[model samples]
Target: MIQHGLPTIDQAWTAQQLERNLSRVLNTGVCNKVLDALKSPNADFQVIAEMLKGDPYVATRVVGIANMVRRRDGVAIQSIQRAVQVLGLRQVSNLMLSVMLTGPLLSAEGQLPRRKDLWRWVIACGVANNYIASQLGQQTDDNPDHLVGGLILGLGAIVLWAGLGQAYHRVLGARLRPMSLNRREMMDLNVIHTQVSLWTLEAMGCPDVMGEGLRALLAGGRDETYLRYRCVEVLGARIAGLDASDASAWLADGLPRLGIDQKHVENDLGVLRSELRQIGKIFEVDLGSWESQQAFHQKIMVESGQALASLIIDHLTMQESLGISES
Candidate 1:
């Protein structure tokens, strides 16, 4: 509607559509059963593992996590039961819930490029958030649940994209031009991804604390419990290839409020980046490749208003507009 031929939907209609989609996904055959099991305090691991074995895609991911845990020892876990044993009951439950929530997007044909990037971003943020939580000595009895909350914080955007389909595709395509996704959503839909994310989390019956943490992050207020975690998410987005200028603003504003010294920011970020790279390997996602880093560096120069940067920006923009390539 604003530009680039993307269709605009009424905000009310978009919300309605998203709710319908979430209901359908949540109430479907195996998914409903899986979600019910995950929410149950007395969920049987053997039953859940058997159910996961039926879904090859979900099973592979479960096995991937197990192997990642044992990667240094070069141990390969083949059976779903064995993988479940390796990951523990709580982790298995969290993984099942995560997979169920993401199943729709992953199953959407012709959206793999975007889906893969979104998955990588979410996982990196989760790992980074965990690192920050550890630094602050915020240990939880259920660490996987805490990590899952961080992983799914950005999921609202993906949920909206899947719910809106071609309408969202147009929005993504427009991202190749001048506008960012948040700005475009604001202009076209009169709402932002964070709002959608909170709605989606609530609809999925996630813990209230998870939604509270996300709300705190978006509001930029200093909640004693969520501030440090939110700062890590901002840093994680930068590490996952968000705009450097945006990250700079987050640091300039949010760091001071969180009582973080400006001098310590760079060293802390370095450690986080190193940790993310290692985590990326375990998760089978490259946090940022050399070429992507170069691209981002050049993009930052353009963002800084360098006179000669326009040509490079235009070239990159054209490539993005014309191709369904990974950023």
Candidate 2:
């Protein structure tokens, strides 16, 4: 695996400080518009949606969500207006918030052709979380937590990518690709990303549960944290396009503490992987593992890290436009 350069504590602290100063950016137009819609008892849902349309990524996510809702209801939604009518207001508001929070992480760039395979794993995790939760018989109220939870379960990875930035870039270039270290171990050495993420979430006034839960999950073991981590592990492996057998093996030894039934997880792994492949097609992210997957893990780490910074800037700008301050 290639070894990426590790960021010094000072660098990590610098990233944390910069992130702390970003709250002013999050309180802008896009966030306020959504919050405003939520407060509207008789507001025009279409108009609220049109306001959100200013961000292309947000627009695409809302449209996709609207279609997802329509499909769930066995109806055809031909326009944003019709779609919002079908999804209703509260649900739409939640969808918008979810998109806003994650937009930056999802839109980063600089994946080499072969390295692009990692994103498939990320998408797989998202699909697996949704599917696994559904299979577990979660009711409507529980659905939002599960969806957001699944989507952000790998939040630690994003945190590392965003916080470590250039140092992380160097680390990956020096380590993973050069040394062939696996993704999991490579990230653990750079704990700054995780720490900074926890701080960022707290700064944003996210519930203590979200931050604590992420900490425990990333701590890596068979305890409560491990169980939560299971969701991301399964989803991530699937996203990488690994077969269930391979995924099972990877998780079994690496996450024995999770106590989740590997057999049960294996049964649905193929299905989860398939779902991720479909999402990849939708996003134009190729899912196949090229020789790059086996090369150094470090080389591409920087690329991933830098992409996150770009995403943060874009999202902060979006929030600023809405007049909603980050916590």
| Model 2, total clashes | 49
Q: Tell me the whole-model lDDT of each prediction, alpha carbons only.
A: 0.56, 0.47
lDDT against true structure, model 1: 0.56
Model 1 lowest lDDT segment of ten: 304-313
Measured by TM-score, how close is model 1 to the native structure? 0.66
The per-residue C-alpha lDDT of model 1 at residue 30 equals 55
Q: Where does candidate 1 clash, by residue pair? A: none
Count clashes in each candidate, considering only residues at least 3 apart in sequence or on different chains.
Answer: 0, 49
Q: RMSD for all candidates, in order, please.
A: 12.3, 12.5
List, residue by residue over 219-326, the lDDT tens digit for candidate 1. 856676566656666666665555456766776776677666545665665555444444333333222232235335434322322221222223232123222233
lDDT against true structure, model 2? 0.47
Q: Write the per-residue lDDT of candidate 2 for residues 43-157, one digit (tens) a residue.
A: 7876876665443334444445555433445443444555466566766665555454443343333442322333444455556556655645655332344555555554444
